[model samples]
Target: MNRKIVVPPILFIAFVGLIIFFIPMKEAFTFTEHRTENPKVYYLPLESERGFQIRYVHSIHLSDVFETYEVTANQKIQLLSMQYEDLAIGLPGSAEEGETFSFQDGLYTLTYEDNVIDSFVLLIGDVDADLAFRYLNKEINLKQQLERGKSYAFSVTKLSYYQMLRGGNLNDNRTKAA
Candidate 1:
């Protein structure tokens, strides 16, 4: 056997195997299926036309990677309709007092008195839904039970901060102008 030929083939096979092991597989290649559960509730401190709109808290959840459900004060599940329209724009369905829209990736916007406020984009994914909901629910429930007035303390997870910082650069200029 020619040693040179044998060595080269062995090296090539090892190199290919290493590449396959190190390279991340695309989501399309993933065999696992994912479904988003109900969103965890969170208290969103909103400042709107209404004076100190803290009473209008929200318990938000994502139905999937794209869809969201906002439980309003009346306990109605309002779907947050998402549309690209050139950007990831979310329009809440029939928002009233104390409603919120949350993405699976942790981006959230609170709607109070027909105005959007306290928008924060968080780093979340299909796997983080349970954590997101738990966090949101804890905060919202605490705020509701304690009746914490304006300027209450809340935790913006590291994931949420990173997501917001990254998405901040991609905000729609048209919306800002309008």
Candidate 2:
């Protein structure tokens, strides 16, 4: 009975659906991929009976380097200063804005403004620190041992604290291999 009006509405709905389907929605519904040729390392200052020591926990991928670090500590530990250093010995690219540093295999330094504050070294990478921490801290059941001199690619998965603590087995995990 109303063929003309019905046809127009159907065509409009189909056109809109086609537009939505063909549009690039990756950026809108996906997590930002933070790639890093060189990654940054993060550490926590741990006090033991022996003395004050730095425990390496997370590495911030260059993609998400933050100005401030969130640390969970039982006692109030003073942060004197923080700085970043390049550890890769033969890697190219210096620590410049928007530049990724290729770290040679070596120890780099992160100098804080105050010497009294404990400092840690972050190996520069394409991802930011927080994302790096999340990736590196994941508890994947190792199918095989990662050998020295070998590199592996991993996907970053976001996990809540409760999930991480339970599924990640983070309750008994240490920042570094003691």
Candidate 3:
């Protein structure tokens, strides 16, 4: 059964398994926690200043809040700024059509322009509200990586080196609960 030595080793193992399942390996910033029984996922790697931030602690104006997202070159999620100190309720009470509200020293920014955002759901604040996720120097304390009150879902995906070696990096603690 030597058909030219098994057709060049089965076409070089199917061209290296189609370049390791279609090459992509990066461009992530995902987090999904669906929970009906179990469903949690996490990811990071989306650097080169694609920017990201999520600081939280405003359970009801307990102060400190800071949105600031930007993964845009097409991946969506714009929302440029939102530093709060109290604008009441869920915040944002002014600046809409191409936003811009300021307050300096005491804090109360807002500054947004396009505001794309394709995914976002957050709800991991049972009470201690310290939820965080900043990037570019890494600072992920999403209530110690999700599952407080649970309700996560954020996005900016693109992962593929076979889904980052079948685990999808939560700093490689090896995730499962799909």
Candidate 4:
């Protein structure tokens, strides 16, 4: 009935409520009914084979009329980036995702089914030495072919007008790879 008694209790409750709201509670980790029942389907790999993720391009798009895809080397590989027009026009291929096509940029080697898929797109604009895939992996550039599910890595600055060609990081000793 007194002001002090009622006021203190109310203030304490408000403070507790504010604290609970500010802090991130356990709801994020808690499993919901629907999520538990309907799990997303994922592709499984062979017992001995090691699969990489959709590496190569996280997401690629064309000017509007063309089609795009997020193809990876393996289950472990995920597309990192596409410098120019990631957009592509399908030339046609076998049942495998592998197909021949052209790229807006002059440089780059896209792999598929453990082989480098040759890509020779017409030069859209001025061909700059730096704007070529030769900067990434020489073996996987427009001239050469790349296989799908193979691991490859390189650091290149897309903004630069010219990029120097260099050796690629490949462990294939028997064959000459980038």
Candidate 5:
């Protein structure tokens, strides 16, 4: 009968719709812009235990500083190490408890133990710092994608497909600075 035929089609359509809605809800490393009427959200597919690095030039020292982090299975960010060239202002002169500091090849490295956080805010340099995000061989010049002088929050979370579509995935584009 018509009733049976219609019911099956309706159920099929509902199932497809649910799949569409949930597919892009997968968790990712999401970067959300702050202090704007309309905040932009950028996301990248991230697997637990994968590592990334943020490299930037110190405004005062003008030297390269690299900070490495890992995504924990519990969706936390763990500070793995920090490499910098300055012992000047704003730089840690000595390691705190549970951290090891050493100098090698013109750079100072501070490796941490259990330094984890739920999220962190990244402030783009308004004056002289150039910040970049590196994962594997792929690099995203965050200074180019985000507004200078603004802050963006980084965390691991889920985002809708619409939001992901509107945001930039620097991995797909090649606007890398030379």
Candidate 6:
């Protein structure tokens, strides 16, 4: 009933709440990199997706990805050695090139030619998720296909202009009013 007593505590609580609300949370932010045509990369944040795809072009896309099946699929699979430090990726087991394996939540038909297990589809679902690829006359050896790592040899938290504008506040489902 006393304004003097009640208002001061209410004001203090409101002030503390305001301070807490304004502070930026690390988990609230996400990052992604978009490879632009030029050296300047145009990065951005992602809202949501069930999954995504990856590709390897030219010769060696990254030092980690391959030009052929240099690391024997059998050997790696046998030894249980993942290609990368993260367990989210690895290669499939096969005795021949055209072997198809379920990789990264999608179907991957790979080719084991030119000393590399280089190209494959990055799928998003158990079925009907892979995008069509135009390999032309290239041999598609699915047997040597490997699950491409999430890092794609390297993953940086992407903050695009869109994400920078939103400041990670958009995706946060918390009821904290802005």
Instruction: Identify the candidate with maximal TM-score.
Output: 5
lDDT of 5 at 145: 70
Off by over 4 Å in 1: 28-120, 123-178
Q: Comparing 1 and 6 by TM-score, which wins?
A: 6
Best by lDDT: 5
Assess candidate 2 and give its lDDT.
Answer: 0.29
The full ranking of all candidates by TM-score, starting with the best, is 5, 3, 6, 2, 1, 4
lDDT per residue for candidate 5 within 52-125, as digits (tens), equals 99988887889988999998877889999999999877778789999999998988999999899999998876
Compared with the true structure, what per-residue lDDT tens digits does model 6 show for residues 132-158?
211222332211221222111112233
Rank candidates by lDDT, best first.
5, 3, 1, 2, 6, 4
Q: Residue-pair clashes per candidate, as listed?
A: 8, 27, 0, 29, 0, 17
**lDDT of candidate model 3 versus the reference:** 0.76
Put down candidate 1 lDDT per residue, 20-104, tens digits, no spaces: 6545331110001113153222223221211211121122423322233343333223444332111222434333555543444
Which runs in model 2 stand beyond 4 Å of their true positions?
28-88, 91-178
Alpha carbon deviation, residue 48, candidate 1 (Å): 42
105: Cα error in model 6, Å: 16
Q: What tens digits encode model 3's per-residue C-alpha lDDT throughout 47-162?
A: 77887788888777688898888888778898888888788988986887889998989888989877786888877767876878878766767666566777868888887777
Worst 10 residues of 5 by lDDT: 169-178
Please tell me which model should have the higher TM-score, number 4 or number 6. 6
Error of 3 at 171 (Å): 12
In the range 84-155, model 4's lDDT, one tens digit per residue, is 333244422223354333444443333343332222122212222211122112222221222222322321
lDDT on C-alpha atoms for all candidate structures = 0.30, 0.29, 0.76, 0.27, 0.80, 0.29
